[model samples]
Target: MRHTLKTLLLCLLLPSAQVLAEEVQVAVAANFTAPMQVIAAAFEQDTGHQVKASFGSTGQLYAQITHGAPFDVFLAADDSTPAKLESEGATLGGSRFTYATGALALWSAQPDLVDHSGAVLRSDRFQHLAIANPKTAPYGMAATQVMAAQGLLEQLTPRLVEGQSIGQAYQFVASGNAELGFVALSQVYRDGQLSNGSAWLVPAELHDPIHQDAVILSKAAANPAATALVDYLRGERAAKIIRSFGYQL
Candidate 1:
């Protein structure tokens, strides 16, 4: 009799939960893919709202949005793109904010290949360093700035391979196509630490802070789920996850 009563109660609650659930479509920056995936899972578990995350370079995603992509939210790798979207009427007014401050890391798949102070760039001991396309990726631009500051940009240009996105650049090193690369700290870190490989956390002064922003799109104006997801991002749960991945919230 008790089991029958519990089953009846469960059946009654299921419909209400289903009615409240909505899926949110999110366009995420490539460097933020891993962390976003974790956050998305947590969100679904906590609120029963499904998150469909699509990852790409910020520039590519911005172009797609302008051309009418159906993403409910846009998480850009830099503040400028969100600002541009706001100016172009692509975003819901006053819906944008900096979600995280990014950090760049010099990483090598082979342990001990990168040093703490980034002196490996001067070593010239390895060839074929990878970076994202500076034209489309903010982290790539920051990497260039860091190289230039060290007076190594021109010197290392011949050895550089550019990826379409930070994920691709990370793959270049992870797959052994390149000896090392400059990638987002979040890519190689979790729980405030790296799992494997050698990495040098770049000096913040070497380049401008990569202030990543999130905005609700104009297309999602009617989406309560989209707004809920954005609010979740700014909440304590999301902030803790972001920090775990070495990002500043």
Candidate 2:
């Protein structure tokens, strides 16, 4: 009876060990937090592989990866980060792919404060505008482009309160630190609809496309869990979820 019990215990332990070995560590862009969380859950459910995630500004993540962060994959807010990693041989060649195109939105906590026609930008209805720090966040780059396209950059510069990441930028507006701010649309969407606040979806013509990309890190290229994650992101299911988050395919 003792021998039989030991055999059954070993059988159970073996599969648990295999499962533990299949886990992957992902470093994701802060802007991608919402969708990445949803996808990570689905990925684990479908594949029985765990995902450990860390979120931060893409620039910060780039610095960490360069210094040998143990992230198995990188989901960047822009293509440039992945490209840089690839050029530096930090990422597996040919594993880089544009996963989504992010959109910029001018949002306000007050219901009618943001004019879809972008007239509020010129109206001087409010005193402050917030945006992510262009030096670190891709959305900030797009925000600057939108401001410049509308000829508001110089005028708005003084009123601008810079957030280190898109999440912080959203907080500035939500907290009324700024009457209006440029933020990712995904941040304000809930249950397939825009939140109670008003927003203007900036036209793509206002800026270069915010192409978000993913790549398997060179250190994890041979890791089954890492490779699986890259493949999972490219799969149809993941793409659909990404699109639902207001990102373009």
Per-candidate TM-score against the hidden true structure:
0.91, 0.90
Q: Give the C-alpha miss distance for residue 111 in model 1, angstroms.
A: 0.6
Best by the TM-score measure? 1
| Least accurate 10 contiguous residues by lDDT in model 1 | 16-25
**lDDT of each model, Cα atoms only?**
0.94, 0.90
Off by over 4 Å in 1: 1-21
For 124-233, candidate 2 gives per-residue lDDT tens digits of: 79888999889999999999999998898999898999899888899999998899999988888765678768999889899999999999999886679998988899
- Taking the candidates one at a time, how many backbone clashes does each contain? 0, 0
Candidate of highest lDDT: 1
Please state the error at residue 51 of candidate 2 in Å: 0.9
Error of 1 at 203 (Å): 0.9
Kindly list the per-residue Cα lDDT of model 1 for residues 1-249, writing each as its tens digit. 999999999999999667544878899999999989988998889888888899999999999999989899999999999999999988999999999999999999999899899999998778899999999999999999999999999999999999999999999999988999999999999788887899999999999999999999998887788998999999999999999999987
- TM-score for candidate 1, residues paired by index: 0.91
- Candidate 2: stretches off by over 4 Å: 1-20
